[model samples]
Target: MNIPSLPPPVTRDKNALVLFSGGQDSTTCLAWALTHYNHVETVGFSYGQRHAVELEGRPRILEKLRQFSEKWNRRLGADHIVDLSLISHLSETAMTTEMEIRVMENGLPNTFVPGRNLMFLTAAAMLAYRRDLNTLVGGMCETDFSGYPDCRDDAVKALQVALNIGMDTRLALLTPLMWKNKKETWQMAFDLGGQKLIELIVSETHTCYIGEHNRLHEWGYGCGKCPACLLRKRGFMEYQSEKKPI
Candidate 1:
C-alpha cells in the first residue's frame, strides 16, 4: 500500500517540532530526527494523565534528548516539555486522572484519550508558529496505539489541513511509525541506535495508564493484561525472536 504523502516542506531551516510523549514511538522518532532532519526539537505534554508515574520520568526523557543533543551540538536545538494540563479541563476522559480506566465489556480499551492527538498537534502547531518550523513530527498512530479515535490517519490529515489554515502557513506533519506495529516501532529504535535504545525504553519508558510503578511486572511498569502491556510483550517477543512482522 502506498503510504500517504506529507505536505511539501515549507520552512528553509527544515526544523521539526515533535509531539513527544516519552514513549517507545516518540523516542524513536526523536532518534530518527537526529539521523534524518536538519534540526528537530521535541515537545511533550503533562495533561493530567491517569498515571502520573511517567510524568516523574520526564526528566529522564529529556536527558535522553540531551544524549542525542550532545552529538548533534548546535544542529539540535532545545527540547521543550510543555505543561499543558489546562487541556484536560476541556474533557473529563479517564486519561485525565485516576478514573479507573474501564473496559467497555466488548469494545476497545478504556485508556483511550479522546482528542489527545488533536490537542497535541494543535499545541505543536502553536509552538511551530513561534519557531517557524515547517515540519511537525507526530508519533500518534492507529497501528498500536491506545485506540483513540484521533490517532487515525484521517484525523491526522484533517488536523494537518486545519492547522495550516489556523496558522496561515503550510505545515507538513510527518509520522515515521504510523504504518508500523509495536515490534516494528521497537526495531526502528534498534535500527536507529542499536539495542541500546530498546533496552533503555523497556527500562525507562512508561506506558501504563493504571499507574503501576513498582513490583516490576513482566516487562515494565504496566500490568500484563492491558492492551499496552500485551502489545509490549508481543513486540518484545518478536524483537527477541527475530519474527518481526515488518
Candidate 2:
C-alpha cells in the first residue's frame, strides 16, 4: 500500500520509543529497536481489556531485555505503562466486552478494538514529543493480524501524518513488523541477537486472549484455542520446520 512517508530520520543521538504490550509482536519490535537505536524506552497501555494480564508482563519483558543489554553492552531507557481504561469503556468488542468472538460484516473479528492502535501510536508519539524523541516504534503486523483495520500499514501511515501535524513535531513512526508474518517475527527476534532473545520472548511475554499462561507449547504458554494462541503456535511450528535439518 502506498502511504505517506514519515518525517526525515533523526540523528542517532535521540532516543527511540516502542509502544510495548509485552506480546509476541511488540516484544520483537522492542528487540529490533534496541538493536538499531542506542536509547530505547517502552510504553504500554492498560485499557481494562479481557487480556489485560499482558500489561503486567511488560515489566518482566523489560527486565529480561535489560539483562540482555547488560550482557550485550547495550543501553535501554525507562519503561512506562499508561492508564487508558477509558478506551475500554469506549468500545464493546471481544477484547473489552463479554461477547462471543465472531467476524463482523466488515470482515473484522470481534476482537477488533476500534482505534486501539491509533490511540496507542498517538499516545506514544505525544510521549516521545515531550521526551525529545524523534522516533516511535510499534509491532503492528497486518499480514498475521486479526483483521484489525488500525494494524494496516496505510492506517498507521495516516495516523503518523496526523500525529506529526497535530503535535507540531517531526517524528518517524516505524513498524518493524509491518510486512512480516508470525513466523518471520520469531525469526526476526532470533536474527536480531540470537536464541536468547527468542527464549526471553517466549518466557516473558503474554499473547493469550484468555490469559492462560500455565499451559506450555512450542511457541509459548497459552490457552491453545484463542486466536492469539493458535497463530503463535502455528508460527512456531513453521519456524521449527524451516530450521529443521534436511
Candidate 3:
C-alpha cells in the first residue's frame, strides 16, 4: 500500500462543499478540506442504502470536528442531507439493494452502483453553484477501491469535465484520496489534525457496509469481513506497522 506523496495540498480561496457520507474516507476528506479551504460545508445523501444508519452519526462527527478546531469550524456550514431514495430504487446493487457481494466479469462488484458518483457530483456541483463555492470534494480513491467503477481516477476526471461543461461553470473537483491508498488515507488524517483527528475518525466514523458496529477491529467497529471493513482494518494495521518505532 506504499505510494508516493501527493505533490502539494491545494489552497482554495473559495469555499468547498464535500460529498460526505459519514464514513471513514469522507470524514477524512472533510478534515482535509477544513485544513485547506477558507469555508467548508458537508453534504450527504440518504439513498436508502443498507448502511443508511451511517448517516445518523454525521451530526456527532461534525460536533466533534467543530470542537477540535474553532477556526476550522467557524466557517463550517450546515450539513445538507438530501433525500435520494430514488437512487436506491434505481440501482440493483448490494450497497443499495439486497444482492450478493460478488465481483463480476467486468471487474465491478455488486457494490458498484452505476452513475451514483456522477449523480452525486452533479448534485454537489449544483449546490456549489448556489452557494458560490468553487470546489467539490469527494473521498473517492482508485488505489484501494473495492471494485467500484465510479471510484476510478479516470472516471472521476472525466465526470469532472462533463460536470463543468454541463453546468457552464468552472468547478474544481478535488479527490484528495484519488492517488492515495487506505494506509495513506489514515496518515493524511493524522498529518492534518494529529492524533486527535485520527482518534475521531477511528471511533466515530462509520465504514461498515453492513452497518455492524458492535464489534471493534483495529480499524474501528465493523463486521471485519466486508470489503469496506477489510480495507479499513488492513490499511489501519499497515499505517500502525509503518509508524511503529524500529
TM-score of each model, paired residue for residue: 0.87, 0.94, 0.92
**How are the candidates ranked when ordered by TM-score, highest leading?**
2, 3, 1
Which residue pairs collide in model 1, if any?
A: none
Model 2: colliding residue pairs: none
Best by lDDT: 3
- Model 1 bad stretches (over 4 Å): 1-6, 68-70, 243-246
Instruction: Output the lDDT of residue 22, model 3.
Output: 92
Best by TM-score: 2
What TM-score would candidate 3 get against the native? 0.92
> By summed lDDT, which 10 consecutive residues of candidate 2 come out lowest?
66-75
Total clashing pairs for each candidate: 0, 0, 0
Candidate 2: tens digits of C-alpha lDDT, residues 96-204 = 8777778899888889889998988888888888888889999888899788889999998888788888888788988899998888988888888688988887787
